[model samples]
Target: MNKVTKQNALRAHSWAGVFLSVLLFLVCLSGTIAVFHFEFERWEQPHIQEMESVTPATIEKAMDTFLTQNPQESHHLFVVFPTSDIPRLVVENDHSAYFADQEGNLIEKESVSFTEMLVDLHLYLNLPHSWGMILVSALGAILCTLIITGIVAHKRISRDAFKFRRGGNGQQSQIDLHNRFGLWASPFHMVIAITGVYFGLAMVVMAVVAQVNYGGDRQAVMDQIFTPDPILAPQVGKPEIGKAFAQMQTLAPEKTPLFLTVHEVGAPEQFIEIYAKAPNRMIYAESYRFDTQGNYVGVAGYEFGEWGKQLAWSVYRLHFGDFAGMTSKWLYFVLGIMMTMLCVSGMEIWLSKKGHPVLATRLWYSVVWGSVSALALTAITDMFYSGSLTVVFWCLMVVNTALTVAMKGLSKSVWLMISGISVLGLLVFYLIVHTTASVTIASLQLNIPMAVYVCWSLYRANTLLKRERMAPSAKAQSGSPAQQTPA
Candidate 1:
């Protein structure tokens, strides 16, 4: 409220933004794109047969076929049913996965490596899950810090709400845009931050909870939070999956069965668990349990459980905007882009104030645009090469930064141009590769928008280049360094 307090808040806000700028940008960008991960998965293998529904017998046959082919013991087996969003049946185990046809035949081994890479990057920063998640989640907490401090720092927040001042080293414009974005999106920002923290810190919280309440038994804590596994006897043949499917119709007629999991496969405690989505509800799924003989056991109670349990269950959908179908997904996508731009603009404000140091600016440009380029490169690689996408991604990132800093007089716009060209090239290459096959609706849905983005990026790059070219002339006439600086 006071001048000194506001100054301190401003300092903290700037410091935190600079501290986590790149990581924050990386996470935000990946997460924004990761909103379409399901589409990406569908695009990855558009040739697969997609069906609206598969019969219970078909699922049974597919399971039998999978088991017969792979005799190796598996801890768990999963059969993901078709939905309006992702209309493909996927049968997988802990070790392998395959797409299944209407006739119950296993098709190609499922390959959505690129989409997985993108999602993993967003979720774990491509680091080992144990540690990367903690670091990413810490960024979320810092985001909250930045948000609060930024709000406090803005003394004339109400009057400045709609203000925009261009020119003069572009610092004023950057500040105004950053402040406006932060202010307007504060609610969304807070939700993302809190949910983001919960994902990774959840493990730590559970561990502490287990220590305090369950004698350090994490499973006990889990059992308390989630539905406990149903008890079953040793005698069993193949699980009565068809019968279980039939029983679900009567058990939870209002819910839609999303997937079925066979827990402790081939073991004494093996049972069928069906995860069904409840209509007009946010909980991820309410799981229904059945014995090997397909006798209905009970439900997971997520829909009718304690408030905490329901809240915990709903976090994924709420965080990812997966609840209301494509409309919600698109809304999240737009807001996510705003969030990603917030990260970039936050750093831009700091960089403008710091006079945009050459090395820092170039490195930052490499990170910002290079990430875009590398994602395209990796996706191109995934089309023909089945290698470590994470390695390719990071290696390209390092190379981009090296080249950007190494090349003299290279403007940041060039990197943007490169990013646009690379994405366009990826699109062209994909079309060429799949020229023989008919492009599915899934591919068209993503590719068309991607083309539009490429055009926009290229246009932006040209505009920036023109501005940079005129900067010197503008400086000569105005005799002001601030006037000559490009935004």
Candidate 2:
């Protein structure tokens, strides 16, 4: 590439990273944690009974108990049976989830808001529905642009593959770290970006498809690719969930049942969809539909269907890294952190090339470190308190950002230390709790990783604090400010 072309590519890369870096950081970090969303849910309420297996009859009894207690007719009820990952029978309605043992005895009603909060943050940054998805998808596209631009602009990227420098030049060290992490994890990052766009922009795609192919009948388009609603019939009898489960086992014994959803309860159109996880399949699950009489209707085409149907069903597993279980989760978590680092260091590169305004640097610190602190605050609060957890999280983030900005002279290292301590504090809190089977395992899962992270944070914080210059200066250059400024 020519000199001018290389410089323009660099500017484009910088522009992409600087504009959406913070939002990308937020999404990536939350998504990393959301990889263990089910475990987090288990941690939130661990005392709920967990068992390896439950009889079909036991499931029916639990559903009956729930219906008898509620009295009011519910539109639907979902029963999520025990699995290796989440070893609990969870019965839920629109409002709340109820836990039950293998013997059909009710344990308690609890909410897993911490996991929900992380999901919301990752999925939409908690924006309103339509705007949130659209914007996040747009950011995904920008990330793709950055990926291409970054590769194009890095003239000696291959030569500097394993370079590491951390001496007098802060920008060089940041760039090295950024490049090392980014280059190693580039494929994973690309996978995440493409899959993320598919999920985030699905509704928009669906709308366009509806207009072009389905005469603007969105439901018709959806039904073609997805499961259609069951035909309405006269209300005859209550669904025998146990019978359905028995028949399902006979139908697909190779698959492990995950969830059973009863639709339109007490209505003529009522039916059941039993979700079963197929072994060694990329598709998340295959839905086994059943009629009101507990007779098996058929399996949803996701398991044995055309290419389009199978591909559509695979989206959830592919995007969330749930395809291969624990190994996939760990891979997703590590790559996710690398993506967050890329966002941060990409912005730092721009700052080093141009100028790092004190306000911009402080706000950057507030965004990065303050978010770390808020996550711990909300997780600890969710464990202890019973109010609205999302509100608590948003408020804590605002307060942390305010404090970071107000303390103008405080170094970013101080914020890092504070967040590190907060994380350790959260670990201590988790330690003091009454640990059950699920809690014990969940605690171990998070605490071990968190310990390593806290150590890294402490080391980074100390190193930064020891620096001669608190804020880095722009490098001496031959170019003018106009060339230095990103497009």
Best by lDDT: 1
Candidate 1 wrongly placed segments (more than 4 Å): 436-438, 479-487
Badly placed stretches (over 4 Å) of model 2 are: 230-235, 435-439, 468-487
C-alpha lDDT values of all predictions = 0.89, 0.82
| TM-score of model 2 (CA atoms) | 0.91
TM-score list, all predictions: 0.96, 0.91
* Deviation (Å) of 476 in candidate 1: 2.9
Models, CA RMSD each:
3.0, 5.5
Candidate 1: residue 261 Cα off by (Å): 0.4
Best by TM-score: 1
Error of 1 at 295 (Å): 1.6
Q: Residues 165-199, candidate 2, lDDT per residue (tens digit)?
A: 99876788998898888778877778788878988
lDDT of 2 at 332: 85
Q: What residue pairs clash in candidate 1, if any at all?
A: none
